[model samples]
Target: MKKERSFHVYAIITIICWSLAFVLSRLVMQELSSEALGFLRYLIASLVLICLIPLLKLRKVESKDLGLIVLTGATGFFLYMIAFNKGVKEVNAATSSVIVATVPMITALLSRFVYKEKITTKQWIATGVSFLGVMIITIVNKGFTISNGLNWLFLAAILLAAYNLLQKKLVQKYSAIQSTMMSIFAGTIMLAIFLPRTINEVQGISMQIIILVLIMGIFSSAIAYVSWTKAFEVAENVASVSNYMYVTPLLTTVLGLVIAKEFPEVSTIVGGIIILAGLILFNSDQLFSKKVRIKRIGNAELATAAQVIRESFATVANDFDLTLDNCPTNGAFTQAKHLKIDLDKGQQLFGVYLGKKMIGFFELVYHDGYQATLEKVAVVPSERGNQYGEFILDKARKIAAEDRIEQIDIGIIKENRRLKKWYQKNGYEIVCSKQFDHLPFEVLYLQLDLKDEVTNE
Candidate 1:
């Protein structure tokens, strides 16, 4: 709990620094071009990080990961800073912050494909709501047309998302400080291309502009990245830390009013509120308590289960290009008739419900007093990350134990490493793998000893 609280504090600090940047960058941009501002800001940030290397005892990144680190720096700093500065110059800090605040949702959406991370149904709705908010802002900002600045900002958001994924991967093998420092150094090198212009601008800058630029660079660019990376390292999940960004628009708005004397337009206000509403919904499960239940389903609900199974497996089918013509037995092509047949054969079907809605389904096919086959474990794509599959598996284990079944076995596609790791984490062991004539991919079989599970329980 203390560690979690610590990371939360760090994350909030990073957000505040970032929020301040949105306002301060606007002030600094009055005298500097976007390219010059980005170059100068991150040059200071890179120098600061360089100064901290020996003090922090940061490790050198391996040559093998150097390419990924450079890519991270390019996306996160070089590209993002240029685009962000351009957008902030064109719009109020509040509006710019709101648009950039979509980074968390964008990251989540991208992770669904890039990292095979599951997003819940509510999250999907939240994404749509947030984009609707962006649309409103875009239309209003340009009198029913999208502005080039907003487009740049959206592209920046995507680059930031890419950076987040790359940083996540780098931080696994490198310390947070090391990763942040290296990325900034690499980004600073790229930003150096604008050095001549930045130097020209700096030579004629007022002392006030100098102070503002320094703050933006040191606090926002350097400290904020380090703090955010530290939060990522300490937090249990990326969402926990990234969610703090939702606070950015509000903070930036307040800061904008106080520092820049800029009041948001009516559209900016309305659009920001809508965006925040969507963000709140995206994180509703964490914000509010949810009632989840698992129970045995009957023939009357088999049709619903079949529909859920088909929808759930359809994601896998789409991902792996499975079809009835190629893998006819794939669960995506399952029908109510097939489930009914399984029911008639004494296989027990179960459904996991969130409130009154069934979001996941699975089946247990008894083999003997000592064993059972756990098959067709499926969670609707949007409801997956909520741990509905784990809940169903837990219920299955309990049912198996009650039936005196000593072992439970299951099979999954060998290419599905994420699912395989999940099952393995839950105490399942790989027995073997086989390439069946009917299937296009190899199937890996896993078994869990219910005897040990019962004793542990």
Candidate 2:
């Protein structure tokens, strides 16, 4: 289904709800230990979801996929929660959140090796710069000190990274609700083995604390997830949807102002802005590239192009949330196109494959006068720090040379200053910056002068 205006409204509301969760969690923590709280939160979420299964009318799954699902549940859902909860016990809530915020960078790094996803040099730079912002918060505010005790937070961060990757994998096959429910329920079951320890902590809870915990369970765990899944469905890109998670901490800080009546320190606000800036760069096209490759259709390839543009897009309609309210597959195909261009150069499009699956794609226009413009290019969660993105850009450069194109222009959104600096390191120079008033974006044009460099070489 196409994302409507309603999805954006729901996403903002979900963020607000999630922001409040930190305040509630803070209060709940005074009464309950982290483990007890983690266990209980998932328990409520799972139980509620299970009760709704009949209404959801979910279908039975193949037995073969059960093991993968269980593994995902354990790593992504259960372990991540436990690690996060325990990490909070060792550090203040602010400190823990700062560390946890690195989840996206970690995921991008892991995705490269585990899933063989390609990332560009610009992406690694963005990831690094963005992570630097995270370090600023931790080192500047939290007092940079390490102890053997802090290992738990590291482990927790790793678990969180794994959790996100698992969610991505599972979301490919199952509806978000189905995947989330199974993982939550399975995770709840696995953690239930330790219920006795948590039971002992229940005696310490006051009525207020109990209410806070319930609210956290219902809103953050259950309701927020439903909204997140829906938001992801309608988002123009999955990464864009995931990027919204970076806002959680900002919301948390604002909520702190309301609930505790405590104004955030100047440093806190500064750090938050820096972090957001880095994330914008990290998430924007300066570090991430999306390409559509098509080819001239010979008689033999017309059927293949039909399948690529028409049928393949149809298959991912639900996954991509392009269903536009569950429109027919034919309706979905109507929105797709296969075009032929006339230019000084004759370029053909090739097949498009993501994670080894061929999907609908168009050709990269290679012409004498038309320059290829590159923009925000970030590594996915699992493919960071691997130099894969550089490799892709190198290939593009070679293609540019072959076609005798004048230059390649990449636009980095200004919100991501980190990526702009990173691009400088890779021989891309910023030529201009322009603001977009309607959207919260500013464009930074980085030009790679092939003619000048080629002559120098």
Best by TM-score, which number?
Answer: 1
Please give the TM-score that candidate 1 achieves against the real structure.
0.64
Looking at candidate 1, the ten consecutive residues that score lowest on lDDT are 448-457
Instruction: Please give the lDDT score for candidate 2.
Output: 0.61
Q: What's the C-alpha lDDT at position 228 in model 2?
A: 79
Report the C-alpha displacement of residue 309, candidate 2, in angstroms: 7.5
- Tens-place lDDT per residue, model 1, 1-457, is 6964689888988999999999998898889899998998898898888787656644445689999989988998899889988988988899999988888778878989997888889899998898888888888747778888788888888999889888877754455577778888888899999988877888878999999889988999889988887786565445567667778999999999999899998888888899999988987776563456667888888888988999999988998999999998999999989998998887888887877988888889988568999999988888866666766766677678767788899999999998898888665789999999989999999998765333222
TM-score of each: 0.64, 0.60
Give each model's whole-structure lDDT: 0.83, 0.61
Candidate 1 wrong stretches, greater than 4 Å: 1-4, 234-240, 289-457
* Candidate 1 lDDT (Cα, 0 to 1): 0.83
- Candidate 2 per-residue C-alpha lDDT over 196-239 given as tens digits, one digit per residue, 9 for 90 to 100: 98899898678888888888788888888777777754543445
- The segments of candidate 2 whose C-alpha lies over 4 angstroms from its true place after superposition are 1-3, 90-95, 141-144, 147-153, 261-271, 286-457
